[model samples]
Target: MTVTRPPDVSVVVAVHDTMPYLTACLRSLVDQTIGAGRFEVIAVDDGSTDGGGAELDRFAAEHPGLFTVVHQPHSGGPAVPSNRGLDLATGRYVFFLGADDLLAPHALERLVDAADHYGSDVVLGKMVGINGRYVRQDVYARTDPDLDLYGSALPYAMSNTKLFRRRLLDRYRLRFPVDMPVGSDQPFTIEACVRAERISVLADAVYYYAVRRHDRGNITYRSSPAQRLDTARRLIEFTAGLLPAGARRDAVLARHFDWELSKLVGKDFARFDPETRSAVCAAVKSLSAAYLTGRILDRLSPAQRYRLALAARGRIDLLIQPALHSGSAPLVLEKERVLVHLPGFDEMEREHFVFNGAFDSRMASGIRVLEAAWSSDRLVLWIRAPVLGDGAAEPAPLGISGVPAEVTTELAVDGSGTTLCARIPMRALLGGRRHDIRLAVTAAGELYEFPLPALGRRLRQRRWHRGRPYRISVIPGRDEQMVVRVSRVPWRRALLWRKQ
Candidate 1:
């Protein structure tokens, strides 16, 4: 028995600088088959200095009964504004839409129909990203969603693509972590999914997720250690606070932790510090206890259970996140050489970016097709001239800056093209937190900055210059000992002398 009334839904589309996309998103949403009486659109302008606030007000004025606008300064993350939505929401269900994305014509209707048919507490849909791009997601449509949270939410993950019963959020006090620059959605969605007694699936792909070549200044783009850990910390605390009163409570809570680690930590480990990293590892290690009483812990195979156990410990047991075959280049397939190229990239002049993993994909074929690790005798990076332009540039050696020692070396490149090479005495990185690696360059009369965090954290963003000099760190192979001190990674000797 689905909730048969013309159920009320609060469609919360949070907006920022993307007024253009926000306009289209709102248009498509209100234009949906579900009319104004069925759902209320709440556009929260999260301190958008770029006219998003005015645009929302204009839209609300035009669509009187269908729209409401909330204006506030940027809360730094999605959770705070989302909580604002919860408080103002007068609907029984909630739908989240990103400012720069849109919903399908029948998205709300299909989700509401599914919810009624199954009397489900939550409805999961799919988000297809990068318009006119060669990729698609039919995640929710293929699943037997009646299977429950662990089963459906496992692969069909993503909060923006789903709709939820308001009580599932209220009962568990589910809210986003405003502290995080990215990944605040994990805990909120996970809590709602697991705690909800029934969930429905609308196999229809109802959302458009636009993936871009370069996303600088995007909220998810400004990832940091404290933000990620804070999200995880809150999610765990949320679980502990809402544990049901019964024998199965421990079991469900344990599985919740397991799922959290499996999803959040793996995506964010290289971006965090050793202390927070250790906490995450411990959280992952203890997740198995959730299975005995969780949504579907008992149903998993022994292999799956062991893998979850390994994941919680923050161990990259290949079973959890497998080893990826590294070394790839676009357009050219040389044994070790790479001709790195991004179409229309050269249009912008002057950049100082080192190859850090982009798009955070575990697969090697992801964006830019480049990943690197340096633990061997020497490290080599080959760069080729796509089309030698007005003034040809060569990348200097990977230099160690921000540390006390003068440990900088030039890399070897064949005279024909630029091949960056670095060789160093092992003394530089002995105690972990002593140094920072920077790829320095001079073009158009200025020195750009790219500072590495300490050893333990991996950097995301394969391409960092948002139209300027770009620098980012390794994303996957994180060294667990060092840390970022005052935005610099200084050696322990320098630290020791300073303390004395």
Candidate 2:
């Protein structure tokens, strides 16, 4: 049965706390080289702060018929609001313009024309990440055989940077799931890719995707292996449910299973205590059978398939597990250990020390270092450590670390999950400040030096260093919308003034 297409084009702009990007995004939509009346922009306010709700009304007032504003509290992801936009859209084609991304002048015209020209349900065009003059690839280029995406399946990459037919969505009953912490674009695009009867890829880069490096919200399971595995398990179930009925699908499912298993057995637990490893391994054993039999595994690679094949055959091997082997101590030059907790997960990661090449180059690949600070209410972290033989370096010697004004030092456990507390009398004795304490940690057998910037200021003498901890920053609250990663950061020392 052939599905009929709609008459006009509908653009869904889901904004939450993204007031800053809204005006630009909306302007881009209405400024389409094709003119305003040709398409309708349905802007949904997903419970945004920073006056996003009111801004929607302002735009609607100015644009009138060309705009439709749907207001709802911030749902988990843009999926729900996008789905809401889908329900109200009357266009033959629909595209989600991420608030942070912009549309090329002809973005609408190109995709719209492509949909009609190829008689395709999906119209994919090239896109470049355009943050300032910095241009990055769109990830949808149809250049490599390895990146081939044909028919209803998407290329291995999923950036909602394409123009899709509204009819195709109706035909497949496709909608985004608001529940997934992240990678929601994965299932939504995959479903469309798998079911798309006709697809087109244009060579032109009409969409500009802005890559916000500071935004960490979309990366829920990035640092936590356990969380990623759990999310993968749920998504695996969803993908499996959409699979074709047969053993071919089982092979595809197996490949994905290997990945989740790797996260489970391979990452977090590769070096866990014996009891912890056994508990997790037991859990995987229980889920492996059903997971392998699921659908959507038809397109997996041989190596990926082999990994799963091994696990499926009760051959959970050591190679698939993630392990960390910290070798011998370095030349005992310098050491600085501070307890820090990044906002999201409940783990206190310690930045043991910053290494300087002052030691041995061989130490670079062996240790990992994290620079942590509280930027606004968000705890931001920048981590870089060397992979063995990865040319790791000791941290550039601390020019200095600056912290906030010296307040009365209090010692207590931050009940938060980062399991950290300065030993009681440890923090108390250091009264009003003024001390030349040089801390050092030998990471990779090198001696490096670090001076506390806040400590320097506490003395009221003077700040000698050129750099301070102010170097670290969070995204300043993401302009109040557009899931740019949110967290509850309390007001505390701007520096402890340990401006390092």
Candidate 3:
């Protein structure tokens, strides 16, 4: 099995003890729609004791020139094997795939096409999580044929599951940091992005990132908090060193703070020992002090802003306060405003304490529900929130966050009032998971957000779709307001719809 000519794409798969999923993963690669001759698989078996090495050999032998196997002693991580694969790659472009993951049928073809068309040094294929959770593909919300890593939201797609031109790698001398036990890919991906002149995005291409059920062997699930924090600090330092101070640098730092460091102050923060908690808080505070600025903080969500501020100030007690009062405060919607009454935080006395704005403007500007109905047959829910005042400006063009404006609803004015309504098909809104839907309105050229008030507890309904029961209840928010909670039927019947 020898290569006479360069291939279109070189897929580098680093495998350890993933025997159960290796077969499917290998099969997916060999049967790629991009054609066997166009691509090659360089499977690195990292001293797998689970017969994954034998599986790799068998695939390589069967595929002949299409598959190559590199057997090496276990390095305790994917970085070493990945670098080895890079050394052996001969294709014009390179792709790194996890041995447990699978690629969509046309993933390679789509990526290659985008790269060729834009002469891109890197092309990011969309990633889909299987039996695992993933961040929303907001980075791919809109397509940009020619994407700038620093300017665009491309930094958020920092995973190594992308197509890279071999030329770019050689030019920048990019390699994964073998010293890192976790998140080694972060530095490599960040460097590649920063150095590459042209990076294209192929939103339609899919890379299935599979999560093993009941298996804690995955490196991500096995890393200790200290190890992760160390990796995060290294990554932040590496990324910060690449870019100068400005909006671009701030954007990247914002993602790290909001997504990675912010986890230290999450609900699970209480589970950590005092020492570990203090170490995490210290690391977060130090990083934030160096990189986080008002511009970056201003763009984050209110919850994120609150937690980050507390962490930066070393207010561990205040940081954990929200978790202690979790679901304790009932949301109150009165006087055309939504309020969450934290035990210590005074809502009435403190100005700008509550999340209120044009939605509760004194000039008779508020939404009122005129009618509500759900059709199980069509899987659509209809709600009419009409403008109350006589001179109201067409209900301020209502929209729902987490939902596309075009598909969420429509606006119409009838004799009753200025109606803001939508025939929201559940299929469109329910993305196979529970989502918090916030109402957004553009009033006087400014956007205002309000929680979609729950119709009423008694008005709640249970509907079935495709043999599964979905409980649509009007739950009170932690703040004073109503939110529609659409959830699957609880496994424990007694705990179904219990008040939070």
How big is the RMSD of model 3? 16.0
User: Scored by CA lDDT, what does every candidate get?
Assistant: 0.52, 0.50, 0.70
Candidate 1: regions farther than 4 A off = 1-7, 131-138, 141-145, 153-160, 167-174, 177-181, 205-217, 233-500
Model 2, span 1-500: residue lDDT tens: 99754445888877776656667777787788866667888888888887878887888899888889988878867778888988998987888777656787887887787778677777666666533324334445452222234332343345565678888889888888777655566678767866777667776565555534344322332335444555566656766787765663454345446555544544344455555455455555555656654343344433333333433444434423332112222222223321111111122112212222224333333332223344333322232222111111222222112222221111112221111111112112123232222223333444443321221111111121223212221222222210112122222443444453
Selected candidate, larger TM-score, 2 vs 3:
3
Q: What digit string (tens of lDDT, one per residue) describes model 3 on residues 1-500?
A: 99477899999999999978889899889878898889999999999999999999898888899989999999988999999999999999999998888888788888888899888988887776777645458677666778877677776778898899999999989999999979988889888888888887766545455555457566777788778778778877887898898988887877787767777667767777888888888887888878878888776765565565556667677656753336333223334444333333431232212434333452123344445666662323344443322122223345667544333443344422234555555664444444455656544445656555545443456666666667665456655455556678865662454543
**Candidate 3 regions with alpha-carbon error over 4 angstroms:** 1-3, 205-216, 322-325, 330-500
Q: What's the TM-score of every candidate structure?
A: 0.50, 0.52, 0.67
Error of 2 at 9 (Å): 1.9
Cα lDDT for residue 367, model 1?
15
RMSD values for the candidates in order, in angstroms, are 21.7, 18.4, 16.0
What's each prediction's clash count?
12, 45, 7
Arranged by TM-score with the best first, the candidates are: 3, 2, 1
Local error of candidate 1 at residue 378 (angstroms):
38
